[model samples]
Target: MNNVDLELDLNNLKMIFEDLHFNNEIQPEQIPNLDLYMDQVITLFESNLFETKRSVEDKLLTKTMINNYTKDKLLMAAKKKKYTRDHVILMIIIYNLKQSLAINDIKNVLKPIVEKIENNEKVDIDSLYNKYLLIKTNNSEEIKASAEQKLKEVKDEDGDVLLYILSIIDMANGYRKIAEKLIDKFFENTNEK
Candidate 1:
């Protein structure tokens, strides 16, 4: 790639990062304190997460997906057919994690939290979700910096885009592997008992 092309690409990349809008994440305060029905939950997610969809036709949350999640034990069953704030929070977490992790892996990672919610333990789920949002805010800058650094380091030779893409894939695969291994080491046995 020529210097002009590189500069343009970097500018485009920065623009994309700026568009991420960390505040776009669903806030704990935004969730209704009162319980919600399935259709309500679906509407809430669709309205809140419309931007996260890659396509207008994509469904963020569906009745079938929620039913399957409950059936698979990834989510707690609704009480009297109504879902709580905790359930909404968990579904958001699950939706994000599902993008990069296997369903079983997500279940393993979330099992303890699910148990706490289901058992009516004083888990302070709002605080936990806030912490996650804080971490997400922190990581966004780190990710942007890393991407900028990688772009600078990438050769200006032909196939620069391909090289950059491969680098990103390699990094993502590495993190996914580490996460899966950690889940295996710490959580694989949780399901045993």
Candidate 2:
């Protein structure tokens, strides 16, 4: 592409990064305390997490997915066809983690807490979810800053879009690898006991 075209492309990419506003995390307080039916749970996720979708047709949660999560033991079974607040909490965690982790890995990660919830024991999942949101918010800022810096470098170097993409892919792959490694270290063997 020509210099002007390349500059425009870079500018568009920078704009894309600048436009990433991630304030859609569902707070625990926002979830209804009353038990929700399947459709209601789906509606809650769809309404609260529409921004997280890459396309209008993309669903944040589906009945099939919820069924499969329960089948796979990634989620606990609902009582009397109704899901509780803890169920919503687990669903939110599953939705986020599924982006980067496999189903089995997610089940492994959530196993202990799932057990606690299933056993009618007190669980502090809200605290954990809140803490996760805090970290995610902090990381969103860092990611925006990093993207701006990288985009500037790429533009200054005559718009090396390939290099910029490669760097992003590398960072994502590295994080995924670390997450997998931690799961292996802490959770993989837990099921065997």
Candidate 3:
């Protein structure tokens, strides 16, 4: 076999060992069934059971309906399994922000809010509402006031796109919070240079 193929095989074996070790730690009795589970996982992978990808244009079209600039961001988040429902709700807020604010400005405003939501911590919605007011007024309040309104109004033609966008947003928020905690930890441990 070529070096690349050998490397790939070695990596696969390492992964199998790791899974076995993890299962042994969690439930030793399950060791006997490990081969069966591995077969299932291999079959699922080969069958494209976890395949999920959306075209950039498709994601953009989805965001366009919502009037948000979060298409690319949401796509990346979804790819990483970090998107969720609340993140989608937050994207509605972002759509309003995009009407008047620059992309960077909108991201700055959303970073903290998304972080809080991902961490399962309380967020100051009033403050966020006020921030939204500073960015855009029209449709902003409506979006914030009724989080589920647009979702309900979404028709069958656009339902899947909307739902996918929402899932991506949710994941993005989760990843954002995880990233924030890691950064905070780094800063906490770092001595001023």
Candidate 4:
């Protein structure tokens, strides 16, 4: 793709970014106890993900995907063709995580928590999900602050949009470097076992 700068309004850009409010996530307590069937589960996904993006159809999830997740042991199997609240919670987490990580990697990341839940150990899945929600709520401000800091660090009176883009790229590269280190540490621990 060409890096030609467009005459974008910075205020509009800020507004666009600010407008990305997260509301699609349903709370753990709000999840219905009435176990949902396959079609109902699919409908839940469709109804819950994005209230906007009218032009975009989110049809990526299907029966096969749910089945595969269950078969792969990444999620607890549905009981009697109906998915429990726990099942729906896991499904939502898995689906969202799938956007950035591989299925196997997702399983690896969640293995400890899922195992605890499965073993009927002292694990509150809902509490864990709620904690995740809390963390997620705080992240938008953190991300915005980071982006602004990156912009300031790269600011140049003579620099155009390319400079800001480069700044973001630098930040992304830094994140990648640290993420790589974390992954290395993760595997190092696993390798010891």
RMSD of each: 2.9, 2.6, 21.9, 3.7
Model 3 worst lDDT window (10 residues): 22-31
Model 4 off-target regions past 4 Å? 51-55, 154-166, 169-193
Candidate order, lDDT descending: 2, 1, 4, 3
**Model 4: lDDT to the true structure:** 0.69
Best-first order by TM-score: 1, 2, 4, 3
TM-score of model 3 vs. true structure: 0.27
Model 4, span 84-151: residue lDDT tens: 88888888888767755656666666666667667878766777788888887787567777776655
* Per-prediction TM-score: 0.89, 0.88, 0.27, 0.77
Off by over 4 Å in 3: 1-83, 124-193
Please list the residue runs of candidate 1 whose C-alpha ends up more than 4 Å from where it truly belongs after superposition: 1-8, 19-23, 156-159, 189-193
lDDT per residue as tens, model 2, 55-168: 889988999999999998899999999999989999999998998998889999998888888898999888888999999889887876777777777667765667677677
List model 1 lDDT by residue over 1-193, tens digit each. Answer: 4423443378888887766654577777779999999999999998888877777899989999999888878899999999999889999999989989988888888888888878888778788899999998888888888888777777544537767877778888998899888989888544566
Model 2 regions more than 4 Å off: 1-14, 189-193
- The C-alpha lDDT values of all candidates are 0.83, 0.84, 0.40, 0.69
Which candidate, 1 or 2, would have the higher lDDT against the true structure? Answer: 2
Cα shift from native, residue 59, model 1 (Å): 1.3
Error (Å) of candidate 1 at residue 106 is 0.8
Clashes of 3: 7
Task: Report the C-alpha displacement of residue 172, candidate 4, in angstroms.
Answer: 4.4
